[model samples]
Target: MERRDIEIFLTLAEELHFGRTAERLGVSGARVSQTIKRLERRFGVALFRRNSRHVALTPVGAALRDDVKAGYERIQQGIDRAMAAGRGFSGELRIGFSSPLVGEIIMAAAEKFRTRHPDCAVRIREIHLSDAFSALRAGELDLQITELPVREPDLSYGAPLLRDQRMLAVPSRHPIARRASVTVEDLTQSPVLVPADAPGYLLDTLVPAQAPSGRPIARVPTLTSRQELLTLVSAGQGVAVVGSQAVRFHARADITYVPIEDLPPIEYGPVWPGGAQSSRMRSFITLVRGLRQNEDDVTRSHDHEPSD
Candidate 1:
């Protein structure tokens, strides 16, 4: 019926307890009950089944929950767009980024964007790759920077802004550190330290068919962040597979980054919600596209230079 009613319904549907939902919404239990009653009266249908112990969504309420949530999200997006329009292209751009390279590119582009549109504001949030898609879908993020070829039908992904090859990071003293390049089979005997955010491409393409079995020696799922993974590798706890950008960021004395010739190269790109393009978003995309072309030209020129 009303926005507040929808919010209350969603909250109650999730918590299924009046007191808990009220606590979460920072309202009184009586107010929450009153709101539900008003909603039911307006709809002429009961939305919840209540007992002394708990509350559960009725069949009609269960069906309505998703539709209401979608409607609320669309309404919120419209409000944000209206507010942004009132301020001109001078409004904030909330970007979601996953990989480190994406962050660097966005920072570089933000500087350029700001110089041209000084009144425009930029905010970047580093999120899990999986969460990036969901955040974009929910209208929380204006743009996303991630690996290319995003499969979601609701989103459209652009071409690569930059490409970085995967590298094997090992302790300098490790036996394979002296090699010019390594392969997945070469890592079979070593305990691999995987970053929780290791891109899907690496997982599908680089992991060995069978690691040398022995209690998995050391599986460090505890390392959630890239910094933590690098730290563990530097400590010689285990070897890690990471992007060249990561190696550039943390060139620790203990770890040596070697090119892995056998693995697939990684490419980072920009993604946005399908059918939600804006003038500001188009401007940012154009900037990134120009940057990518410049990078390609530089690479090509270097490739043509004579070898010593």
Candidate 2:
């Protein structure tokens, strides 16, 4: 099958909606239907079972998807690498960040990157939790520093850029706010507000399905933005587990940020599509690593110094 054909099939299989598949691929619904029909006829079998309201893959289609997805991804990666190599690192490098702290770091890196490679433009944007991987997959972003545990098969990640303590955001008047620290078990006292329509693994990291004691924690999928999440917490709608940086980035009079007594620190890192890295991307990665190392060294030096 052609690359576009494979893309359409895989996208339709994943989306299970003709209109959505068409929208994602920048084609019309009729085109998507015709392509699927052509593929079915060429294969001499029904690849999909569709009706007025639903679309589903047949057993043969499922097997084909499982078999070809990895190979197709590799082919795409090779094409990307070849194209990037042919271009020789003179175009815009798009970077994305998921949080304010990451954004600050990316901004600093972009400045240094531009200074070093004046010919290459650096475009930075903020990525949200709800639609984390789509932008990267759609080629809208080259790299993003997002929370870890990115288990996507086609993406690659690097070492942690920032590690921050996990904290619970609660209303100032709430009983949990009086505590010095809290734990996953404490989440049971109130519904935990989480980012809506996020991946399960990410949501699990922020707020687990069950605490250590096997008690179920109630989750309220109401968060859409940082401000909205904080507003909800301040209004006593629900509590949320957030990174320590929120204390500085999202300070509010009505909310108190309490550190989680037992949860591991949240780690943010660079995630990029394809296994191969372009020259511009590799240079930016190196710069970011060097800056982070310098910061760590300074922090350690300060910690061991004698006071006057």
Cα lDDT tens digits, model 2, 51-145, are 99999999999899879887986876566457545766577999999998888878888998777566689999888998888999999999888
How close is every model to the real structure, measured as TM-score? 0.60, 0.70
lDDT of 1 at 119: 78
lDDT of 1 by residue, 188-208 (tens): 657777545445553444344
lDDT of 1 at 305: 100
In model 1, the runs with Cα more than 4 Å from the true position are: 1-88, 130-138, 152-154, 197-202, 205-220, 302-308
Best by TM-score: 2
Clashing pairs in 2: none
The stretch of ten residues in a row with the least summed lDDT in candidate 2 is 76-85
Give model 2's clash tally.
Answer: 0
Cα lDDT listed for each candidate: 0.73, 0.85
